[model samples]
Target: MGLNKITGILPHENTCADLVPMAYFYDVLKNIQKVEEDIINMTYEDGRQPLLVHLDMLLTIARKYPNTAAMCIYELKRKHLKDTFEAWWERNQKKIPKKYRTGIRQNADELFDELFAIKSWAKSE
Candidate 1:
């Protein structure tokens, strides 16, 4: 299904718009269950990766936007659902994602450093 546009969409600090990528991920999960091989073989027009677009992009979206919505309560629901998905997928024969050194990296370095004060010494000196 080549890139197309249709949204049954949400919002906002004065209409601040956003898209929950995890929604796409939920659809992908359904497809994975229905046709695991087909989902695994799928590709995107944009480019390629070690895994299928669904595995890489949609799964990454699952990580990035884990929650179905922006509210705190929704995050809790997402955590539970994600945990369930992980347990279910673990039983499948298909291989899980592999992270080579060249694979996509999370934009989490500064957050981790700030959380652990990894660079706090620099500030004092």
Candidate 2:
């Protein structure tokens, strides 16, 4: 269905509205990759590779957060993100609090992994 690439949302705005539409876009990305994989069927140059639709955007954020290792291009990577749960908690436990962490289950890696998977769609952040 034409990949249905109607629009994209700010990945990390996390506002009520910004997040809602992203779910649909991810689905579209998955389907397009699937179809492309079947058509090319080449391991060396597979459809599994996601093209950066907007080079300018990627370059902008890339320079802004030169060392950013966030999952997505537009999402700004935090500077103090830690790798171990203990380390992260040491830094955040006070601000976020242990009581709040009581029933939570993710380790630092998993937590940060999903923390900024998406990025702001705004021209500048």
Candidate 3:
């Protein structure tokens, strides 16, 4: 995606329209999931850190749009299923050198599982 397209999707940090409707927010979530999948599937030697970065970005976006039902369900499931993994990821980041973190990054397959589960939960309403 182009930089302009990305900027168009996300709101300004302090905007009054922060809570976009559930449908609109789901669209953004879907795109973020697609980008995350691409990052995970990237096979180059330097792909993992970028993948983690994208995952972090997606988390941040979810937080920003917390009022949306789809985002809410996604976040709740994420907190339940991956909260420990996320904490581990953060702890490891501080404990391990940045160079070594990539080797221990979350796998693409696991990410797909979580993403699909969240998608399913979001659609159940």
Clashes of each: 0, 1, 0
**Residue 69 Cα positional deviation in candidate 2, in Å, after optimal superposition:** 18
Stretches of candidate 1 off by over 4 Å are 1-19, 37-51, 68-125
TM-score of 3: 0.34
Off by over 4 Å in 3: 1-42, 69-99, 102-125
Q: Write the per-residue lDDT of candidate 2 for residues 13-48, one digit (tens) a residue.
A: 333444444443444435434433433443323211
Ranking by lDDT: 3, 2, 1
lDDT of each: 0.34, 0.37, 0.46
Q: Which ten residues in a row have the lowest lDDT in candidate 1?
A: 112-121
* Residue 21's lDDT in candidate 3: 52
On lDDT, the candidate that comes out on top is 3
Give the worst 10-residue stretch by lDDT in candidate 2: 46-55
- Model 2 CA deviation exceeding 4 Å by range: 1-14, 42-125
Model 1, residue 67: distance off in Å is 3.0
TM-score for candidate 2:
0.24
Top TM-score prediction, candidate number? 3
Worst 10 residues of 3 by lDDT: 39-48
RMSD of each: 14.4, 17.7, 11.1
Q: What is the lDDT of candidate 2?
A: 0.37
